[model samples]
Target chain A: MPGKALVITSGKGGVGKTTTTANLGLGLALRGHKVALVDADTGLRNLDVVMGLENRIVYDLVDVIEGNCRLAQALIRDKRTRNLVLLPTAQSKEKDAVKPEQMKELVKQLKDEFDYILIDSPAGIEHGFRNAVAGADEAIIVTTPEVAAVRDADRIIGLLEASGLYDPSLIINRVRPDMVRRGDMMDIDDIIEILAIPLLGVVPDDEGIIISTNRGEPVVLNGRCRSGEAFNNIVRRLEGEEVPFLDMRGDGLLEKLKRLVGLR
Target chain B: MWEFLSRLFGRENEASKVAAKERLRLVLVHDRTTVSPCLLETLKEELLDVISKYMEIDQAGFEVNIEQGDDSMALVANIPIKEMKRALSRTKN
Candidate 1:
């Protein structure tokens, strides 16, 4: 059977789209599925750096599209796992270098080989966004809790619907539970109620994310941090397992207070 | 410290998230409808012109807004009328 193609997108930049892509793709591969992480950002590619496979990328998405290299030659196999590979895009090409039809064809070919193909889209609702979304069977909208990020998420949701990819699930990333406890940050409930989509999972803001990114090692490999556990839940959820959300309400004292005030 | 005290005192309702929610609600209403504040202003002027033909309306008190509900939306117009026209001149019945 062919694999599934899922595009990870957020209309606004700096909301962890690339990080989510790398972690989720690697997370799936760690579970014994053959996964391909495609960087569709073209001119401003970052997934290669995040995956720590930058030195291995002699070929890219543009090279494969223009018949410069075979698909097998362009894919960079992860050093950590034999099941995972990344098809990095060119850092020199423009967003218009690859067309939507070409993206669709590339995804089709990838679906035959891998169990999951995760496309990391560029920020904004322009050509790059369209190209990233064109080939996917489903979309995972990633957004932070801030007003600007959620607003852009709302717009991306509308655009996804307009493009015939409906009912895309959401991942609320970088949620600060302490802020939510203080009612200073928007909670999961607020984001869910606003987006009105099925919840995949929620990732907490972790300092370990910085350390992992610095070393080009995915946080999921650590498997101890809150954000790592959250990504694992999302990976399982994608595989159709029913995993409950983490109780990010801090320790016992705050938990008791939250329960007293009817907050979760 | 003040923030912690407010949370402890059950004053969480007044937290900044309330303001964020309200702001997101208003902004999304405009975004989903693709209607800008400028467009709403122009629409209000045109609506006042048509409503004035039948009744005297309070222009200052006239308001038009798009309110979002759970699973539905409403284009609500709150127009205060001074008096209804007693004589029907352009009545085509």
Candidate 2:
């Protein structure tokens, strides 16, 4: 397959776009393909910290875009993985510092050398969001199970559809099976009923993500998180493998059968 | 059952189905009809206005909202239907 660029975005904040980017980068890289993750959230950057390369970012996205540094000079090689790289955004620059064209050219430069160029977009329909998805061949819209999150995800989907980027897919994150069962929280069925994008993966709520993120290590490096496995499955699916979506909700087989039969 | 299963055996199609359904339900209700929650509030006021011409009514005891779908919002206004003259007589002294 040809090299692909994917921008992971959400219209609302705190829906784990950074975490998804880091994990997808790790998951794709671990499969032995060269992957570069770019932070398009220019001013408020965190992809470096999530990928654990915060202290090492001497040159950043702004530097590369503004000719302050060469493309290779701004690339921060991940410490643990040879296949993974991070193009950290310059923390001090405004969202308008880098034009959408500049970001597209940078990704074009990286696309030939990398298997997947994942852009971590800021939360909103503003300049940062536009610049992030400008060069992409695909996108993964991360959203939670909340109504507000789902509503914002719809807006992002609408924006993507309007942009003519049909490569956009959905990843419903932080789903609580208990709340879903009690009908208190929205289920994957409920979310899909609303957003209407092609589903990529479903990541269950896991505490390991917080600890790993704080330490500048993504949960992908940890083995216990099923969410990490789910991300890996997404990567495999991206690689053209047919993998069944494992029901992590531990849904009763009988319950599913009953739903299939249209019985309450 | 077999026909339906055969139709949706693949991964890509089903995911799109779920996404499409959700977007349709929320946006149509929110943006399409102009019958949003705010409009429902105004409708409540209008209903009160129409009824107050004939009788004395309790404003706080009523509630109005869109239900089921954006097009078919239910207006269930609970009124005591107090007699205007009888209620006014108690204050006439």
Q: Could you say which candidate leads in lDDT?
A: 1
Model 2 agreement with the true structure over B1-93: per-residue lDDT tens digits? 765775556444445434554555656566434455777777878988877766888777777654455445454556766567434444345
Candidate 2 lDDT over residue span A1-264, tens digit each? 557999999999999999999998998898899999999998999888888898898899999888998999889899889999999998888999999898889999999889899999999999998998899988899998876777788778778876668757899889766555544456787677556677888888867788888888878777656666777788888888987775745558797697578673
Candidate 2 residue pairs in backbone clash: A192-B18, A193-B21, A193-B22, A194-B22, A194-B23, A196-B19, A196-B20, A197-B19
Q: What TM-score, to 2 decimals, does candidate 1 have? A: 0.80
Model 1, residue A187: C-alpha shift (Å):
0.4
lDDT of 1 by residue, A1-264 (tens): 999999999899999999999999999999999999999999998999999998998999999999999999999999999999999999999999999999999999999999999999999999999999999999999999999999999999999988999999999999988878877888899889998999998999989888999999999887767788899999999999999998755447876687578674
Report the error of model 2 at residue A183, Å: 1.8
State interface RMSD in Å for all models: 1.9, 8.4
Candidate 1 global CA lDDT score: 0.92
lDDT, candidate 2, residue A215?
Answer: 88
Expressed as tens digits, the lDDT of each residue in B47-89 for candidate 1 is 9988888899988899999887664578899999999988667
